[model samples]
Target: LDRRSTFAAEVCGCQVEIGAAGAMGAAAVVEAAGGTALQACDAAATVFQNIMGSVCDLVQGIVEIPCHSRNAALASMAFLCADM
Candidate 1:
């Protein structure tokens, strides 16, 4: 998450906090479920691919608008991955 936040800030100029949490947490859950390293990474990458740019760039440019809900959805994904 730290690396992702740094890279996104330096390169993409965005926070991407929830995204990092969702992807990394999902990967951790997959690995905890006995998946191979590659499989875990793939699952996390799939989650990122699905949600990376979904609700960002809102007209208001404040995180409170869509970010909270997006974070909730990401948290749900994390729990779902854990369950799997």
Candidate 2:
């Protein structure tokens, strides 16, 4: 929940869950799955950095157009980050 992310959401607020909030949840999942705290944090930070932007403009009131792809990509990425 940094200003840049908040601003990105405010500027193009569509799927709030698919953004920083999603990454935060991903981190907790990593930690719960026996990942180290640092790993969890790294996963979350990397996810946040990867998807961080006012890119919610792609979510034009639907899930088919890039939203689903973004979610899948990030969800998969969280595990990779944890492993790394």
Candidate 3:
């Protein structure tokens, strides 16, 4: 139970940190591109949605199955979002 709790905390922390960083980066890009507040926020929303955590409990509870692909997907999504 403690391990699960710790995992949950780590997941929550990543969500907050990555989401905020992406949002801020999106906003900055939008501003630099001469976009309005609404546009910036919309871009940030797209980023946030894309960067949300992926499922990490696949393959009969085997840890590696989910860890690699899930984290890779998250990183790719973040890059794609930033490019958008």
Pull out the clashing pairs in model 2: none
lDDT for each residue of candidate 2 in 2-74, tens digit (9 for 90 to 100)? 5544535345553455666557766877888898888788888877677766365455576456767777777
Please provide, for model 3 over 1-84, each residue's C-alpha lDDT reduced to its tens digit, 9 standing for 90 to 100. 134333252556444455556666777777887878887888778877765664345579665565556455555554455457
- Provide the global lDDT of candidate 1 against the true structure: 0.67
Q: TM-scores, in order shown?
A: 0.66, 0.61, 0.53
Best by lDDT: 1
Predicted candidate 1 versus true structure: per-residue lDDT over 1-84, tens digit per residue: 464345453353333666677878888888878888887777677667767666355556664666677778888887575455
Count of backbone clashes for each model? Answer: 0, 0, 0
Every model's Cα RMSD, please? 3.6, 3.7, 6.6
Q: Point out where model 3 deviates above 4 Å.
A: 1-11, 55-84
Runs with alpha carbons beyond 4 Å of true place in candidate 2: 2-10, 13-16, 54-64
- Alpha-carbon shift of residue 41 in model 3 (angstroms): 0.4
